[model samples]
Target: MSDSPDDSGALHLKHVLAAAGVTDLTDVFAIRHTAKNDGLPDLWTASPEAVLAYTREQDSRFRVFPENPPRSWLVFMDDGSHEGAHRSRFYGAYENDGEALSERTELNRSFHIKASPLLAAMKNRLVVEWTAPRRWHRRGTLAGDFRVLEIADPQVIPFVGYDKVRLTYQRLKAIVDDPHYSRWHSALSAVKGIYLISDTSNGKQYVGKADGGGGILGRWSAYAHNGHGWNKELAALPKGQCEHFIFSILRVFGPEAIQRQVDEAEGHFKEALLTRGKFGYNAN
Candidate 1:
């Protein structure tokens, strides 16, 4: 089946299949995989290997068609958006029955599948709107049920530009640790800037500046590694309180900008925002 176009003329999964030269779908099954369990890492930011391992585990959990399992499978990971409208990212295509079927257990009944080169280049980059949340798996003959979201850049996200930056502590830590967010690293590392660390849990804020040691990225990296980033006030916070901090840029300066300029900017923000008072987190 083909994806029908809407009035917006947005592309759909059928268009992607057509582009991939996958016209026939009789033996193809499409599946959406999510952590489903709490405390698991979000699939959107998880490492590729982790995503694959999770996918394999979910794929083997049950057999919808034990006697006539599909020969090929289309895999996706939940994008962690709105309940009904989030796009699911394509993980990979696979061939079922890659090995002899394992003995069936109450939960392990599906055939083992091996990754195929089909749409290999599109992994992480291709996202489709999976409308069938209740039915995570469906035969590929029903391709029209899913719509194309977009073919996004493979990075966790590109540099959102300095003024537009806003990151929670966990996301900031992920960007610092994950190589996939190299774009953010490269962009942030090139600029010296004034930043705000707001304790979202209590609404208190700290004004800080990045003038050296690898620029904004380096300064933020310190905060990501230790919630306090050596700041006396933040260090005094009870354990894990820093996890509520949200980082954002207040002003960006080039590498050529002098330390004095950055310091002055930081002072201005601290004074203007009353970030050094009892209501704020800044100690200085």
Candidate 2:
């Protein structure tokens, strides 16, 4: 029942039930015997609303058991036959724990009647309810045409104050230079975007788009060494204080679109760093 449905059969049943105005079993089963006599599935499906309406009518006297775990319920017939209806209540239909049921066999046997037809009707309704797809559901947006903007703010946090930044850069360089580092470099190339490491503190600014060679992590490994200007800046941060942020652009763009986007983002990153003020503008 938890599986997504490929068709609309489940929805059709809900619509039919709503139209019948029969919400409980009393009114639902009270219909002419001829209507009830039809095949159980057919009868229930034919007017589900009526059945639901009828069940609601009996809400006052129906006794549900296992108050804590909510195992089952007993619906008594007005005829006072002592044999009440025993319906299983499960959080989910697919969870079948026979061991628990066997333990409670005595209680079940005493309260439950062999009303297969009624049980089948109830099961059918539950199936419909469980299987129906949620209406008006929206899927999350996929990352597609992503762009990396450059950081233009010259006055923003400079990669100079922290000692950890320099150490992280050294570690990164060592990681990328080793033969084993090729795989890591390849992985970073696939990342959609990379944040320029501005300061060891709260100074993340999206700066550039990575060429589809790998992911952000991979790219970091690649640049960890090489003593580039950015690497030197990162190396200056306090040990263990430097951080890199990478964003993926799977949903937003084709190659050309992402390139332009990244360019613009880098520009914004620069502007933000210069204007934001916390990035060590006065130190140097």
**Model-by-model lDDT, in order?**
0.76, 0.30
Per-residue lDDT of 216-275 in model 1, one digit per residue for the tens?
Answer: 999999999998888888899999997888888999999998878888999999999999
- Could you tell me every candidate's TM-score relative to the true structure? 0.54, 0.26
Q: Give one digit per residue, the lDDT tens place, for model 2 in 157-273.
A: 212111112223544564456555454344444345534543334544323334454444544544453333254444455555533422222222233555767667655655655
On TM-score, the leading prediction is 1
Q: lDDT of candidate 1 vs native?
A: 0.76
Cα deviation of 141, candidate 2, in Å: 32
Task: Output the TM-score of candidate 1.
Answer: 0.54
Give Cα distance to truth, residue 9, candidate 1, Å. 3.6
RMSD of each: 9.3, 23.2
Candidate 1, residue 219: CA error in Å? 4.2
As a whole number from 0 to 100, the lDDT of residue 112 in candidate 1 is 67
Per-candidate clashes come to 0, 73
Off by over 4 Å in 1: 1-8, 38-40, 45-49, 58-67, 82-84, 98-100, 154-220, 223-284
